[model samples]
Target chain A: MLAIVVLLVIWWVAYWLKLQPPHLLPSPLDVWGTFTKLLTNGAVWEAVTKSLQRAFLGFAISVVLGTLLGLALAQFTLFRRAFGPLITGLQILPSIAWVPAAILWFSISTEAMLFVVILGATPSIANGLASGIAQMPSIYPRVGKMLGATGFDAIRFVILPAALPGYIAGLRQGWAFAWRSLMAAELIAYAPALGIGLGQVLQQGRELVDMPMVMTAIILILFVGILVELCIFAPLERYVLKQRGLAGAKR
Target chain B: MSESTIVPDSSPRAVAERSGLHVPESLIDAATAVSINRVSKSFGNDLNPDGSLRAPVLKEISLDVRQGEFVCLLGASGCGKSTLLNLIAGLDSPTQGTIETPGGRTALMFQESALFPWLTAGDNIKLALRLADVPKAEWNDEIERLLELVHLGGQGSKRIHELSGGMRQRVALARALAQRSKILLMDEPFAALDAITRDVLHEELSRIWQEQDLTIIFVTHNVREAVRLGQRVMLMSSRPGTFVRQWDVDVTGERRIEAPEIAALASEITTDLRREIRRHAK
Candidate 1:
């Protein structure tokens, strides 16, 4: 509610200041009108579904490989010594930076877009899992062993649950990376057969000087990211925290 | 709080009578639950340039705990009492000696409850039961029985955070029991509780120890707590900890922390413990 009020205030302030023409910086009312128009057109829905498909597929691949890599890095000293620094270095490399290499490797294809998303997301997920395992309380393992949870059983029952918070944090970061990388790929790849995605829609709006269409695409992109975070990850994280008695309602 | 027999009869006559036709295979298995001989432990970084070993935490510590004996290891803070207990618990190995526990498995209880916060009270015990190899079919009944043993029969479903400190420790005790081990090692399990709660748990521990026929090696810095619970108290010296003294408190019935005999024994031990500390000052 407060966020909506803040957005309204920013919009009114920009209009009052006369900072830019309506064609470049569309008014809040104009953006809203565009939103309604796109909602009825069916084209916006197609782009949204396609963007979501790409993001989900790339994020899924990143999670599997990243979790495996993170576990190995955390558990084995040799593996950590060899690749830990390099993995952390990868996290700071921008998702946009991968577009050029991905285009060269896969040649303006969906596979190229996927390559960029996975590359962008995997390090953050892996780092999250590794740090989570590293931060586990020593007492957890002691109690686990005393109770006869050994090796794989210990990892499954004790280590994994203990590391859930960190892993979830990693997942959140990975999703952000995948989303950004997907948009960057779609904007740059220019594959005619890839169909309409939000990134492509925004790029086409730029080419045609359709400011309302660009603004609509931007709003949808932001809305989708925030929606998934609130609807999926937030609830999942809250449930885990609540189960551990770590989450409490404010007094 | 039914006033059942909280003390076991260790009398020769009782032993002779029990050694008759009713001798079970478990009874004939081992006379001692834990045997530690000349045990010493040291910790230091091996990569240190000087290559000199750090002073041993515990040294030349030899002790034997008979089956069903409640023994307390009493010492000052740095006496390595905890190190000795860990060695006996098999959490760590002794640097210079051997620890033998012929008694199948041992369960250890820490000062903190250490219950998994994610689990309900009942689920905590169930995890222990699972690890102890209790069959899945028997878990419900076994969980109920163990909760009842800790006097927490119907409170199993409560989350760990909802329980009071005393109740949490009781749940910890129940989890330990679910291990179904021959020996229970308690590392000052009640040291953190308030006086009233500690007194109550002392009684609870005494009753449970007798009923379960468990051999317990309890480590503590509190003299009264040691005297209140143990059949025998062994004092350890600090700095390369070694057994300095042992006292057998010959109380036959349930013992209280405030009992005259307990206070007297505690004072004597305290005097010896202070002297050991003074020796370290020089």
Candidate 2:
């Protein structure tokens, strides 16, 4: 309550002082008004839905590719020797760094944005899976073999389940990468054929010097990020960890 | 019972014939459930280029377990008791010699429960059954029966973390039993529990062994545990582990851990084990 009150006080003081003029630094209330206006006109819903669809499509591909890559890296020594360092290097490379190549290949279209999202997320997901497999207790495989589990049956019944915690953590990180990469791609490449998203809204607001619109887009991005994490990833992770008795009581 | 009365049978064939009573023809191979023929195990690549210096972890050892027999391998920490158990479980191969088990599959239980954290107690048993090629249709009934056999019964839905240490070991026992193997190899399964809990588990194990008519090869560093559980206890020496001594415990009726005969036998083994350790120091 105190933090909110302090923030409100700062907002009101800034408006009253007319800091940096109304057009450049719009009051918090003006930003709120813009958000309500966007909601009433359905612009916010349209932009959010389009962005979510692209994010989901790209992420789905990443999940399949990443998990397979991770399994290969863990199971085969040749794959580990070949691509392990390259995968780490890709993870460290910023999502925005892929934008130039993505645009060059796909010509600033939805395909280009998707390319960026997949590149941004795949390495983290694969690396997460690899590390999880690597950290699994050696006793598990021996136990599996004693039970007569062999080859793919061992991988399915023993290895995959044992490495789930790390895999899920990787996916969470991958989602973050996918979202940021999508936004970066949107800001850089203005493909009129592709629908407007929050990133595009922010970019348009900058060109028009519409401060309230820029703030509105920023708030929406933050809200979506928090919402997805809380609704999907957090609960999924907690349930899995708790079932394994890896988690303590929730606060 | 004196130390001298507990004699080592150098020839296991004679011992098996003497102990062979209830063993079935199909179940027993030449009246023995397991035959360890001059077995030896070593770690790392070929030891000492010269063949004279043999530092194998387990040296040429020969022993036999009669069908439905309860045998304990007792020694100090580095005695390769676990190594011997692993060789029997087929988890590792002996460097020399052969271990023959005519009874087909064998189940191994570790000191730690080794239960998959992701699986419930029932599911863990079910997985064991599935891996052992038990038909899917019988899994539900078999799972319930196995749980009840371990005294778990309706607690099948409970996760591994929900179980106490003794309960987890019971669940592990149920999982091993799910293999439907004639032999059960336990590596100090009760070593992690409290004294009270260990005592309870010992009774449970003895009861289960009798009920199932299972051949058990239990490995432990504890002397009293061996006396309380095993009909015969085999002691091993540590450095280049070798089967050094054996004691055939002849106790009528169900022997409790605190009984006078059990205590007397345990003390004798403890003295021998201490002497073995002392020899290592020299």
Candidate 3:
């Protein structure tokens, strides 16, 4: 994109002019050299695989928990009145804020990392489903009852399908928060037992004051985020919107 | 076609009847399908000084829908016609008194198709069939039969969005039929359609009504639509809606939406409806 071109040009200018110092602003080529060296040393693959595996596991748990929470909050009036505000409050609280407590309780382990990721992603996912259920057209429930669908049957067949589009969008947002929280956990809770992940790579670069290595890690993080958006969220949303015929229902 | 005769698949239904598929012997009347005895509905809590409820929508409404009868409830915009229909459909209960549809559950068709977009036409009917306790093995055949009844045969595979507006309504009708309930309540089911489509659907509905032996309670503001379809049209007054008048439509020939007899009766009903509306202005 033109924005990438502009960014590359600015970086080249800063590096060429030695705006700060040779140590601070490395050329794009230098960053590329460091990226290739990491790839050849197998650190890039090792870090990517470990980080992504954690992301997958954490996200899977959050989705299951979030969906249950969303349904409970949406269906049971007593449950919603009790826990809805509390869950929403949890959403606004930053995942990074949990790092210290998590480190203490989990002692710089995978548990510490997963604890933060699950906490970060679950609320957004739940809220997504809650909002989706709330925004469902009134006709669905009424019709569901007319056809003898009561309680759980109504929730499963009518409410769930009607809330699907919103649920999917929630899933995408949950994934975003999940990835970010995982990275933050990695950066803060780096240790030998945790293995060499992207966050650990960035932390190592920071300790060594290696500019090119830091840039490579940041680019990889952004790359994964963009890749998920393009490969998963975009197509899923398009399919749902198209199949539902967004314009047909009044909403 | 009489109840005593054994149709080809009557054995299963016979067994189902014994197993309480239809309403029990004591509760069900052979002639009447739905019995609404002095039923009333209201919205909101009782905040009045005398402890009367706030905003009564239907006031002491009474009606009996006989087996295979086609009755239409005609009224102005603010009338509790839809609220009454909802009460009858069991979507909502009467705030006072009771409504008894002793012929098992009823199916209601809304103005919009209200079909699940994620489902194909067949699947929509399948849900209704499933809820109605139709056997799983017979689902494919039942769906085909119902779709065919609505003149939508072999089109069950199509997505709801792929169908035309008229087709969607037909699919909705098929879904309602799939419920296998003796009663079908429609609340302005074709109000959103074009004139031509509406007219065509009316004819199809009349044919389906007789063919399927359904007792229908159709609600609408359109008087001509009521005249064109109902065997008996009940005109309701708005604002605490109650039946003000009733006309037994007995045209001796084919009834069209714009037939002279229909127009004449509709105009008479319109005059009364206008008077009811005028009363609100004061």
lDDT, candidate 3, A92-178, per-residue tens? 988989989999999999999999999999999999999999999888988898888998899889988899998998899999999
A1-251 per-residue lDDT for model 2 (tens digits): 89978987898798889877888878788888998998788877988898889888999999999999999999999989999999999999998998999889998899999999999999999999999899999999889988988899998999989999999999999999998898898888876568998788888888888889998888888889778889999998998899999998593
- Local distance difference test, candidate 2: 0.87
Which regions in candidate 1 have their CA more than 4 angstroms from the true location?
Answer: A1-22, B1-30, B45-54
lDDT of 3 by residue, B1-282 (tens): 112221111122332364334433432334778878787788875646986556788878888777777889998887999999999888788888778887667889999979999889999999999998999999999999988888899999998989999999999999999888879999999999999999999999999998888889999999889999997788888767888766668675799766787888888888887887888768
> lDDT per residue, candidate 2, B1-282, as tens digits?
334222234345554465553334443443577878888788875656666336788877788787788899999998899999999999999888899997667999988879999999999999999988899999999999988888889999999999999999999999999999989999999999999989988988999999998999999999999999997898888877877777778787878877898898899899999988898989
- DockQ-superior candidate, 2 or 3: 2
Candidate 3 has a DockQ of 0.67
Tell me, by TM-score, which candidate is best: 2
Give the least accurate 10-residue stretch of model 3 chain A, judged by summed lDDT. Answer: A242-251
The candidate with the higher lDDT, 1 or 2, is 2
Ranking by DockQ: 2, 1, 3
DockQ of each: 0.68, 0.80, 0.67
Per-residue C-alpha lDDT of model 1 across residues A188-226, encoded as one tens digit per residue: 987658898999999999999988899899889999998
Calculate candidate 3's fnat: 0.78
Worst 10 residues of 3 chain B by lDDT: B1-10
Docking class of 1: medium
Superposed model 3: Cα runs more than 4 Å off: A76-82, A247-251, B1-30, B47-54, B258-260
- Candidates by lDDT, descending order: 2, 3, 1
